[model samples]
Target: MTRTDIASRTIAAPVARVWAALVDPVALTVWLPPEGMSGRFDRYDASPGGSYRLVLTYADASAAPGKTTADSDVVEARFVDVVPGDRVVQAVDFVSDDPAQAGTMTMTWQVTAVEPGTRVVFRADDVPPGISAADHADGMNSSLAQLAAYLEA
Candidate 1:
């Protein structure tokens, strides 16, 4: 059975701005990671079929363990679809020895214009069994809040 999680938030920003946050590598690095974590993009190509590598490091070294090596989680991802100002779909795989976390998971981000702002929806499909749904939802919500803050600044 495939596990899925979805989270949505209304940001006080335009759709274009939200889309920029999704596609721009620098913007993504600034707002993508959850609280207490930092992200760095090794490579980023926004077009369909383009791939990227990102490393996420925890603020506390002790927090790493089974999730990743030492203090960082490395993710290799490819863009499956990109619809400007609308949606983005990507496939992601974590670099880990644990078999439960070894498969490709698809994530989709949808942006819609709403009154006075934009609504952003984050959906993850075929999530690894090793990941907790509550934690994933919280992280996604945190990321969304960070995105809103980034755009507001």
Candidate 2:
């Protein structure tokens, strides 16, 4: 089997709460980023064949119209499996015009209850050739940290 891009985090909240943050669109926007990032859900039906779009926003004084800032990128995804509060499998796609620049990767989030907290494991497969795996790893870690902080708040 091919190795996947994986990241895991332990959240100091119950499995149900952490799971809510992962699957609930309203809750997801609360902690999608460490910086000025937020997501909006369009058709967030969490089930096989269900599609959703997450719009990420950032403040960019220097950016031109229809351009993303250095701090934000919007990722639209469709769920492959909706495992309630335990696991969620989805295919994440970065919205872009170029086919070579555009591709889809599968993201799986697993939540396990571990005493006064929940362990969330995230795995992304089929990373495009041009993307940096390490960069994604760093970003994912930061995002999870942000999620944990939001949960605590």
Candidate 3:
């Protein structure tokens, strides 16, 4: 059975700033990659029915090989819904030959105004079995932390 992973963090920024970062492709490349990984975007179109391609490279691929290549994990994602300053929902698929990692995962990033900050909630549904629960949680948390830092700094 497929799984779902959810992570949340409060960012020390207004919802507008956080939302801008969430929708901007360049901002994503800066803070979306988890710890120990860096990412690049081949193409990006942020809107309903639009899509983007992201390639994430590991710092040390020898330790944790990638699904798309020896050192990279490529992703093709479509924006299902984009609500400014509110939420973004996407359908994400990994570019990999391995069946275990094959499938469209629904990703939702939701934001709500909080005292002196914004609460960002990230949810991944229908996660492929190839991704471990522990790793997914860590990655999501890492991304959230990075987002906070990018906006706060």
Go through the candidates in order and give each one's C-alpha lDDT. Answer: 0.91, 0.73, 0.96
In model 3, how large is the Cα lDDT of residue 48?
Answer: 98
lDDT-based ranking: 3, 1, 2
Q: Give the winner by lDDT: 2 or 3.
A: 3
How do all models score by TM-score?
0.96, 0.81, 0.98
Candidate 1 residues 31-98, lDDT tens each? 99998899999999999999999999988867545366888889999999999989999999999988
Model 2, span 1-153: residue lDDT tens: 323788888889998888888877777777764354455766677768888877676555244121233444567788888888889999888765545336778888899998669998988888755456676687678778888897877
| Model 1 steric clash pairs | none
Estimate, for each residue in 22-115, the C-alpha lDDT of model 3 and write its tens digit: 9998899999999899999999999899999999999999988999999999999999999999999999999999999999999999999999
Off by over 4 Å in 2: 1-3, 34-36, 61-72
Lowest-lDDT window of 10 residues in candidate 2?
61-70
RMSD of each: 1.1, 3.3, 0.6
Number of the candidate with higher TM-score, 2 or 3: 3
Best by TM-score: 3
TM-score result, candidate 3: 0.98
